[model samples]
Target: MTSAQVAKEHEGGEGNRPEEGYERGLGSRQVQMIAIGGAIGVGLFLGAGANIAKAGPSLILMYALAGVIIFFIMRALGELLLYRPVTGSFAEYSREFLGPFFGYFTGWTYWLMWVVTGMAELTAAAIYINYWFPGIPQWVTALVFLIVLFVANLISVKLFGEIEFWFSMVKVTAILGMIVIGLGVLTLGFSQAGDTAAVSNLWAFDGFFPKGVGSSLMTLQGVMFAYLAVELVGVTAGESDDPEKTLPKAINTLPWRIALFYVGALTVILCVVKWTEFADEGSPFVKAFEVIGIPAAAGIVNFVVLTAALSSCNSGMYSTGRMLRTLAENGEAPRVFRKLSSTKTPALGTGVSVIFMGIGVVLNYTVPEKAFGYVTSVATAAGIWTWLMILVSHVRYRRAVVAGRLPSSAFPAPGGAKLSWVAIVFLLFVTGLIAYDADARVCLYVMGGWYVALVIGWSVLKRRDPQVTARRREPEFEKL
Candidate 1:
């Protein structure tokens, strides 16, 4: 078959309908920043302390290694997105490459995954607020923010994009500010509030990797989890003004993003503070300022952390809403989910996503402390599944490419099969490691159960819809 024939086979024949809802509404800049913003989450700000404790200074290398794996994942996704730029990107790819059953399962699985993440984001907002008031109930706080963001999403897609733009900007500014400030402290050799130590604190204690390779392995869970949402770029490709233009730019820039955002920030912190101190205590970002004897650093970092949570919440809402609408488009969900409001946002889909997040309020009300970690683990598990699909999709896409089916395109993910296989191995390893850890073991079971449920659901869906037996086919253009 020719490339065009392959495209047609992928989209379910000539009768495959063009999308009616949601125009190419976002700018290239908005798309770029959204990708950057979505990838950099509160984990880097808050979870780094735990990672530092685990690998000692070697946590940096762990993040770098994880980034390499993630880069492959994104590259595979990028290739797939370039092939079929649709609202239901990943889910659609699963259907095209694997089969309808695979598509239905992956689509709904991803939708549920983001719903869990959205809930976790709302719950996190409450915890961050408590650092300030310490009096208000976390449930109330979570609900209020959820409702507010829900309304923002309902009003317009543009508003959601705008809000996310600024929210992401806040996160970027804070991390960049910390990097700049940390660099100054590193070079000038300023004294921390609690310690009169010099800038060699990073290696001064026991040298990097104090816990050996074991600690580094332990820390991979946290760092990789933080990077889980990086592929939100592929998800956003459908709504972009031009996927051909924007998606490639975003995917190609992954390396710098990993370096500057993850590596750069952690490097500065380790240089300024003793990894042992942060491991023994808490929040290296906040503690670094306290060490410098800045009285209000905690307050400032708290505010920044609060913004980070809100940013994640905003992105979560955006991602889940899109995923739900994509599911609807694929006939896996109710047709109502694919409907867009006058403002071109999936108003109903957005509402449903927020309602799912509202469940977080209940969790916060009933079990405030454990709610955050529980939801985070669940979200992580779901995200891992989504990434696994992306890897699988890429492998299948490459087979098509080699079969003389796919045209060369921008935004290529290197290491084709080799990296894809490595990423799959790493994913399984992460799951196994999670099983080993007392806290993360539950996620393994939860994700496993979720996939099983998805498979059962897929069987019912295939049985009910004879049309799903048809394959999706796409048209090919020779040049970009």
Candidate 2:
């Protein structure tokens, strides 16, 4: 079948479609909050300290530049979502526009990305818990938090939305508060740690690029990791109550989010407390509040960062389940995963994902110190693949549009296919940066093995179920 026919077959039947199994319970407010929450992860809250230490204030420019590229990628995704919103999102786009192999690879690779990402988040959550409960073992904390979040996700999508809403509110409120307080300190000439708060602090101790351009370039891996989950909003298009309105509004705000949460907040922190004061091991936000003599600053910042980690974990569980269900629907995964609960939740898929996340809990026990860095590196590399596929799929989608195989999108991407190529090159450069770092090179190696394994698994599945493989090759949808 042609790509156009495939799109119509999967567009959710008029009245009694199997797609109805997914509850469109996420309202505009929840979606907006999910977008905000996805953009701001524990990376910004905690990992920024290391980047700032390495790049000094030049980290702001890194974020701004990366944010622009990310915006182009999102616009590309937005155009595709507007063309045909589906629960599968990028995976579905890849299937129709690129090819079935790409579709399979994108779907499963994305699922693997989130599963590992959830592991990293769970590790961070455990570390954060140690700040308050030094007596607890890290593995115990990780396991407990994983179970709690897994249960929360299994209940319903609405509950997931509510949990994310409050979690995002905490992160947003904390950043805004820090920005306001940092500005106040600068204007009122508050002195703390024998250094007066002033904009001059950005350059007084050392120039913005204190470590040189090469050193700043080294931090791009971590900087990109911070933006890992930002495109999660596209995943929500399947369940959003008003995807036509909410998806655009949520995506359009990417620029300001980078400005305020990343650039604006980092500028304030540097001005309030010199970048020299931040260490690679602790949160700059916590240290800034501490230097300013805020009582319980460590505890407060710890609580906020903990919520940020949990929020990411929660989102991971939610997205992995949906992606798996999409795979099953497309005959790329086990049939059992296609079943949804009466409440329209992918209970089986979520349970399976949580089972895999248990490996993270085990790693916390065996390699607590290295688990976060290792898993995060792998997740970042996996994220690069997912983003690259989005750009590729969008390019193919535009070709289909021009060839009269698909209609023009209501929310067309600016610059169209050319911008996608630019973004693709930017992603490649970042991947190269990852290879340049001896510590991060492991991620690429692991990702190489992962793709090899996926090819083997795909081959095995195809041989075992020739009919399902044939259906996948033909590009026509069948009713569940």
Candidate 3:
């Protein structure tokens, strides 16, 4: 079938899924794993070390604080997902509630977020490999992994899900093992670190907020970035075999995921080793293992974190393709992105996104010292925008339901629209934090230029395709 035919078949055919053109290949197991994988990634594996150096043990509080807000955001999204689950959950909700312009901006910005995030991931993966192969160039390794993941994603969604399932499995297993080991050291007092390892470590070393509360709050940018892809489960709503059953279950587990993998893990790691000893450039997990004198600790944690980076980059590839197709179907992006290969992959979107991510290779080559910092700052800024859109969309969605313009969701949030507003304000605060940081402030400038480009592209699209400016139809209450 032609590309247009495929789009029509999926979106407009009677008695068909809204995500018809897409393959429903991601089963429950894969969705759960994807959720776990997204919850923990390079940000925690690597970024936390730097954040800890600055925030001290207070970094754990940063994560817990942010985790609560993240829970609110995901529950809001869960409500919307049940209302109308699609691959481009953020963009679609914005289109329906906010307007076409917000939708267009959200769609493209999310795509950009993941593309740069992919770059950051690729760079991080290379750094992880450097633990063993110090001689290889970072750019070379970044290029190799980028190409491998691109090819893997090109084959089929099932393959992507399968690969993600295993990648997430490694991350989950690694964190659990690390936590267990740390707890053992704390209770048994057998390992070398055990002599000094105590819960008192958290308050010792000049107090928990050693750097003061302001510095710890500043770490929220990186802390929130650590939780960035936790929402990828919403994006998978389209391909999930059972959206209602799987999406809620996946989102519900996010609290403990954040607790165990982020807050809980950090608490244990800090208790085992003083946060002061962590190097800004190294993985804390690796550092903890090495401090405990575990044999080959560096190599073992390196491999797990390598998978974490690759896993997030892999997700970037998947989400960008689906977002591109969403934009294309709505006449915002290039229609060629609407095409699915015989293998049911959005090859064009994935291909184009990977090419953009190749910019990371160049960044790694010329500015290896600063590539991860630069790309992550930008990705975090973009992620904040995408999240704001989601919260705002959820708030608007709740307003409509209350006004009787739409039906209430089956999985309504406990605090309703109030929590969404709280999440929005908190995200805006994080955005303010990003602006204040000199190193991260540049991302806001990048986003300023990006918004200008999006506005221009949107206007251009408006003239060429009337659908680009068309407002979405209002849905009646009760049933589809």
Candidate 4:
């Protein structure tokens, strides 16, 4: 049968798993790059300035500590993905291990998270474009980028993968080049900045915690936000060529990617120029490059950050569609969302998501400065919820396996439930920190509203289409 036909055949019943219908066009390299790209966003490029102004050199410790928690989260997710790799990701696991309500909430919450994130990325991309084309309106650039990525995602999964691969390559190359240059300044004294380039810069400025320990602690909100999309790899499992192998490999590399990109890069930048020299005005990378006397430093770094923005927007386009499809398959969303196009893509759902994402262009046109910031905290909270579900689901899945109620996974997480609990607690602590921040605390209230909305939505779904909200049949271990 044709793939779409097969996909249709398997639908209309809860017997099939959520990941079955899509094409596995993503290869190992694409999966790895997606993971890397997800980990590295414009947050590092631009947002770091404000964070540095808050935490000083101690920001490195926050990223490192959070990085460890993120690793545990991914390892837990990795175990579940190996057992039942699906595009539905944590949303699906939540359904199986938690219940239909949680699955429904996670699926829709993830969809909202990416849709808003797409808007933010588009806004960021448009602003970066303005640096080069001063007359082009932010809304115009945002619309153009949204259309390009939407079309790319619909054409085929492979095209989406290729677009992301190249986008991530630009980001990876820029960070690597900057690190190498920074090291040269420190060791071989390559640049004029080398005159003062000393690792001691990390300590010389206010002894690392210049703003006090509480100030450093407060940067956790931004640090965790920077780590938001690393879980994108889990969603790629359904479309990956060999998920069992690729997913684990993609997740395993997250620690080094976090280290090199966040911790290592920051260490070098802080070493090359003390944290005190950094400001919340623009990219520390751009400023450092200018200090190093690199030609067109602003322009080059702008291009890189622009790519960072577009890369993330592209990912949002790709993932939101899949999340919608997963929700549809579970009857939590409209039935039409489950349909696959000739290219084996969720065209309808993706198009709907893109339409909503267009609101970002409008926001950019109107609010320009606050458009991205307004939605970022909500997105971070949504991400934290997604991670919480993954850890909880993994813990539950492990317990079932140990009880022999379900077979063990091919890839088991080390330290099992204990590690998952640690990650969960750390995430909760971050959530508490978010609640503590006056400006950020509003997200908690927003999320409170979101939860009530979900509760209402769930009640409506269960009443209107009992089948849509039907509990999934108990999971069956795959036959060897």
Best by lDDT: 4
Candidate 2 residue 38 C-alpha distance from true site, Å:
0.7
Residue 468 of model 4, lDDT score: 68
Cα lDDT tens digits for candidate 2, 371-431 = 5798899999989998999999899878867886566777889998999999999999999
- For candidate 1, lDDT tens digit of each residue in 330-367? 67777888777887777787788788778766765677
Better of 2 and 3 by lDDT: 3
Winning candidate number (TM-score): 4
Between 1 and 3, whose lDDT is larger?
3
Task: Name the runs in model 4 displaced over 4 angstroms.
Answer: 1-15, 478-480
Q: What range of 10 consecutive residues in model 3 has the weakest lDDT sum?
A: 1-10
lDDT of 3 by residue, 1-480 (tens): 322233334454421223558888899999999998898888898889999999999999999999999999999999988777778888888887888899889999999999988877788788778878999987888889999999999998989999999999998899999999999999999788989999999998999999899999999999988888988998898888888889999999989888999988999999999988987778899889988999998788889988988998999999999899988877888878889999988899999999988986686667757756878888888888888998999998888889877777778988999998988989989889888888889999999999899988978887887765875634423233
Segments in model 1 whose C-alpha atoms lie over 4 Å from true places: 1-19, 191-199, 279-281, 469-480
**TM-score of model 4 (CA atoms):** 0.95
lDDT for model 4, please: 0.87
lDDT comparison, 3 vs 4, better candidate: 4
Question: Which is the better candidate, 2 or 3, if ranked by TM-score?
Answer: 3
Per-residue lDDT of candidate 4, residues 1-480 (tens digit): 322233345443343557767889999999999999999998899888889989999999998999999999999999888776778788889998998889999998999899888888888888789898989877878888888899999999999999999999999999999999999899998777979989999998779899899999999988888888999999898888888789889988988999999999999999998888888778889978998989999999999999998998899989899999998887888889989999999999999999998976686567756546768888999999999999999999989888877776777888989999999999999899998998888878888999999999989987998876777646645221
TM-score on alpha carbons, each prediction: 0.91, 0.94, 0.94, 0.95
Angstrom error of the Cα, residue 31, model 2: value is 0.2
Q: Which residue window of length 10 is worst by lDDT in model 4?
A: 1-10
Q: Rank the candidates by lDDT, best first.
A: 4, 3, 2, 1
After TM-score superposition, the amount by which residue 112's alpha carbon in candidate 4 deviates from its true location, in angstroms, is 0.7
